[model samples]
Target: MDWTRQTRFSDPGRHHERLAALRGDVAAIGGVVRNLTVHYRASGIDFPPSRLAEIDTRWVSRMLDLDHERFGGAPLDTPRPIEQRLVGCCRDAALLTVAALRAHGVPARSRVGFAGYLVPNFHVDHVIAEYHDGSRWIGVDPGVDLSDVPLTPAGLHTAAQTWRAMRRGEIDPSTYGVGPDHEIGGPWLILDYLTRELAHRMGDELLLWDLFGEGIPYSRMEWSELPTELPDDLTHLDEIADLLIAADAGDDAAEQKLGARYAEDSRLHPGATVFCASPRGARYAVELASVNQEAD
Candidate 1:
């Protein structure tokens, strides 16, 4: 896939001008994009219920709209207090970073997975932007202060990597999830994110909470809708995880095979609408659209 091309989710639209000012600085851009859960706890800031819903703003243009509306066309370097920033999740940070990088003619895309840096022994589901630096893809965590630094294991632990590890019994799937306290991690979650990693790799870069696969047994509308038991396809998911891992390891043949598999399988790519189980609140179906035309 062309990582440089803007997906509908990453296209800056009318706010295209704003991205130019950021100069493709992922770390600085991440600052202006407030993570909903992180900033709230750090600042102890109470917010309107509607404000929380901003997590569902999937389009980069819409996010920029909110940013401009709040800050009045300020440059991304200009620090906005936590309260004034657009409330979102790690996915927002990654999407905006990818958008900014793509704006400056850099090839970038978001990667979805679990992170071990958040909680000790727990891999929190996370997203980060990856830019193709001529020869290879580099991961950058805009949501953190790791500026211009290469992502190590302490940072983003890809779901594909973790999935393979779980399969080998090298790590427990239960330790990888939403948070330490939240009841959201398990092998099922890992199974879910494996599809997410594939989708991101395919350039869809959908939200982390968006489900995949066919029907209730293999997929659900949201985390709340998940079945108590694991999907009856651990063996199937393991095969997918193996392909994804091999591709990431720079196997040219594996990349070719994985790309073909993803294209042939509808489950690896989201359709016209994503069933959003917004962490902020509420569950709804989101119609997918790319920026074929500039916004109003």
Candidate 2:
């Protein structure tokens, strides 16, 4: 099976039965994550802090199952559709959005990167779902609805675009990172996004905490340690950036080469069981070690 092709992870066949069970507002779907941040303030409801702490659910089926379990039998959950439940982060939202789009015959995929406009002075870690309309791939933030906000490079840029901008000194690499307290930015963050985005483009969209190959743990390391930890040979990354751009534009050869290159690099594993940190700082094992093997 080609990693570029959709698999059970993106296929929505099993969700057909529940499609009619409840209706969702595409516009408001992206606001689900925002509402969680506000504690459903727009809805005038106060949820427990724990409601927004879990981040384990990675599959669409599990996410929908959890949604149904929380709202399926209750009329209270129906009145406010935007604030249904909060069980995931940006990656979960992107994956579910991709599944929803694919169910409707749209070519969609989840993207792992950073959003420069979401937070002040930081290129925050983020994920989004992109859909192709027979010509171009449009970025869609599954976690935040940008219907009101104008779409701009600052608001939402793919990992490739962000990398290019960083390479050309268009954007300050020091300003691109997770947050103020965790100033994890610069070349290391770009490299992390490159690997994650490359995996996502290849159809293996992993959870935020999931580790890939010999990728450095910049999230946990001190800023000074990043340079020494990163691979010595990084010239291939520029080639990857170009290949990603071509692949996005529907170049089959570029996609094939990208997949082949990724496969040959032992440092870029598609599967590996590593400890993943939750939003609450709790650590647990995420089993993605057999994902690529199973796909084959």
Best by TM-score: 1
- lDDT by residue for model 1 over 124-242, one digit each (tens)? 88888888778878787777755443343567777888888877888877778888788778877887788888887777777676665555354444456767877566675677788
Model 2 C-alpha lDDT per residue in residues 102-174, reported as the tens digit of each score = 5555677777667867787677777777766667667787555653222246765667777777777798766
Clashing pairs in 1: none
lDDT of 1 at 17: 73
Best by the lDDT measure: 1
After superposition, candidate 2 runs with Cα above 4 Å error: 1-8, 11-14, 20-53, 73-84, 147-152, 215-230, 289-296
